[model samples]
Target: MTANPVYEFTEREQHILKLLVDHYIEQGTPVGSRTLSRLPGIDISAASVRNVMGDLEHMGLLKSPHTSSGRVPTSAAFRVFVDKLLDVKPPEKGTIEHIRTLLDPSLNDQALVKIASNYLSNFTRMAGMVTVPRREEKPLQQVEFLPLSDQRVLVILIISDDDVQNRIIHVQRNYSKDELAEFARELNEVYLGRPLAEVRDRMRKDLERTREDMGNSMQRMIDVAGQVFGPDEAEDNEDSMLMAGESNLLGHADLGDVSKLRDLFNAFQQKRDIFHLLERCVSADGVQIFIGRESGYDALGECSVVTAPYEINGKLLGVLGVVGPKRMSYAQVIPVVDVTSKLLSAALNMRN
Candidate 1:
């Protein structure tokens, strides 16, 4: 973990390091000097390759797990590989179609976020997550009130793109059907298509003005509408989101240590911290790579997260990514995240 960013690596060192890392990633094994010598363009003998690996180990970029075995790149080495030595490849045609097919435009945002999570997991063979967008920032689309028992009622909220959600609450008294309809009409009249927070603010102003001039019953009804839409404060942009493929992580041998796996599952179960991390990526210009300990979470020390923020116009909607072992194929997963973000963004923008 040399922090100053080693820019002094020579051409030979870079070539050998890239060859070893690529081999280790593809084969999922420690790379010996013998393996390096077999690389297509490499003309060096095993002895020469050993010298390079020993130099890399001394620099703390690689590690020897045993006395005479192969060398494994350290997290520092991975940082160098991803940041400098690696060459990314275009996503395969099937990868693009997987994204397009799963994230269908006909689906709602919620459904597609779930799909994105699953697709990332299935494609990358790791855990995947997409933070739910804060959609309440827009004007409320429609409102309705339905009655069940004498004292119970359902309040429905329709936001952008006809996304409908409902909640039930109990009231002190019962109202007739006509009375309920009148209340619904009044609520729609005042707050229809207005931002929920703005509606709350405007209601406060109107309430103060009408409190003195209107009957107590009308004032009470307005208070009820305020209670209906005011609970969430109009912020749907949440760190809370959907995740699929957590079980997939359990299958990775790198996470086979029962205790660390348990801890990783616990971290995923309590998503607030991970969401905070995802929220940080929303401001990054492109894909953000967190390699192992760089994530600042111990449970994720053996993992890597590739996250990209998706947006509508310039407004960031949410972040999506694949979570896998530190040996994940960056060339493959990067484009998956990058393209999925764009697709998710385009999907959201279509609602406008």
Candidate 2:
């Protein structure tokens, strides 16, 4: 399924290839020259059509499956179709409004992400996915420290009215309630309203410069702060993506192989590989499409992944997209993904 380099096609070659690919996509079967010859816009005899199809097969754009005399467009053909031939169909105005209504701005970010995933699946009849927004981007609203027994402290981080995170960190020694309160007060004064990522970096620098000069109590407080403010390993280990309609892929004929479906479902359940794939698209601008074998995962070798990064105020948050057979309607699916990303971004922006 590795891609072949693009080859120059004559006007007749492009026309015949487009007709064959379109028919195969619609019918989900090999296309014969006889069928292609009769298709609209193809004013060629069956013999002439077969000759052109032979040329296409020689160029690695089409292949004849052993079970059938007809031909199927190879991945290379799809690549050329999307890149040079496909005319993308934009969603209608009503479709835009419908997506907007579904992605209501009043809903919280998590709820919005779920709705987006579900909508993509429902609309495309394919597996849909959205990455959970990064936790460190939220602005800090407040911080609190409560002393616990055996040299441990409960650190509470308030990110917003609705978002709060709790972490328990072990300290070198226990401190009085008043000392803990003082430490919280000083940290809040310096780091309040900053993003958690920024606060973590600044805290690291502060600890480095002040460690030798500060008293033991202050040094201990800084040590506890370092532990508390560092990246959450637990959160990192948890799945950062939300997926919907993975079972929908079961209905796609091309992906019906039991072993292939099993591996695909397992990849969905494990999520690490897919999440990393989406992460690569985070830095890409606008929509990114990965055809068969382009995704670099064996389970996805028969699938096409269409993704677009969603953001707020021009800052990227995460990626969202659909996964389906390579024969998917790129003309429709492309705009659907593009518009979903925009609507999701708008909904999140309303929250901020």
Candidate 3:
């Protein structure tokens, strides 16, 4: 199928492509020439339809899995259909009201993400996922330091509302309680209400310019801060990907391969590869679709992902998506993801 370049499609070819893609997504079955001949608005004979289908197959847009089975649109067909022919259906009023009712203004952002994921699963009958917003370092409200035995100090960073991060730092020499308390006070005063990434950078430069008499103490503080606020510390936290309805993947015929299904679900349980896929969608605006093999994971080669990046006040918070078979209806899923992202942003803005 990959050997030949795709030829420019004629009007009849476009009609066949649209009908095959539409019917295939609905039935998960291949389309026969007889079916195309009888389709409304397609005034063509079965012989004509067969010839066109053959040309499309030669163009690498359609394939015949078996001699008896009819032709089916390939992933290439889907890309062209979505990019050129597919029409998005606006979300129903009932679904909009349902989303509005569920996305209460008072609910926290995390709660809203879960709600969105659940709604996507229920509506699409597919595994739903949402990723929490990631920051290199959170905005600090306060910081505390406590000394421990064996030249170690415990550092507590209070970030966001009610969120705390803990780190342990080793020191070169012993320090009294007074020095620890003074350092804590200095840190809080210097970097309060700012992201730790900026704090770390500012402190690093300031440490280099401190008075010679106070150099040793400042250098020790810098070392401790370095340990607690390393660039990669954020990656060590618990996984931020939230998922629901992974069980729904079992219901799709495209995932009928039990081993592949197991691998897909296991990917969900691990949450790393799933995030890696969704992470690519974060920079993309609006709803995005990844068809079979486009996800770059063999476990997902038979599956499709429809995702969109959601924001709060124009800031990209994270990504949300539906995972189903490659035979998914993009016309339907696109609007759901689009509307959910809007509702989620509105809900978060209300909370803020």
How high is each candidate's TM-score? 0.80, 0.94, 0.89
lDDT of 2: 0.88
lDDT of 1 by residue, 171-250 (tens): 76776667778888887887787766677677766656747787876876766675675544533333367778899987
Rank all candidate structures by their lDDT, best first, as comma-separated numbers. Answer: 2, 3, 1
Those runs of model 2 whose alpha carbons end farther than 4 Å from true positions after fitting are 1-4, 213-217, 231-234
What C-alpha lDDT, on a 0 to 100 scale, does residue 203 get in candidate 3? 67
Sort all candidates by TM-score, best to worst: 2, 3, 1
C-alpha lDDT of all candidate models, in order: 0.80, 0.88, 0.81
| CA displacement after TM-score superposition, residue 237 of candidate 1 (Å) | 12
lDDT of 2 at 71: 98
Q: Which numbered prediction scores highest in lDDT against the true structure?
A: 2
RMSD of every candidate to native, in Å, equals 4.2, 2.0, 3.1
User: How far is 292's C-alpha from truth in model 1 (Å)?
Assistant: 0.7
Residue 343, model 2, lDDT: 94
Q: Is candidate 1 or candidate 3 better by TM-score?
A: 3
Q: Per-prediction count of colliding residue pairs?
A: 2, 0, 0
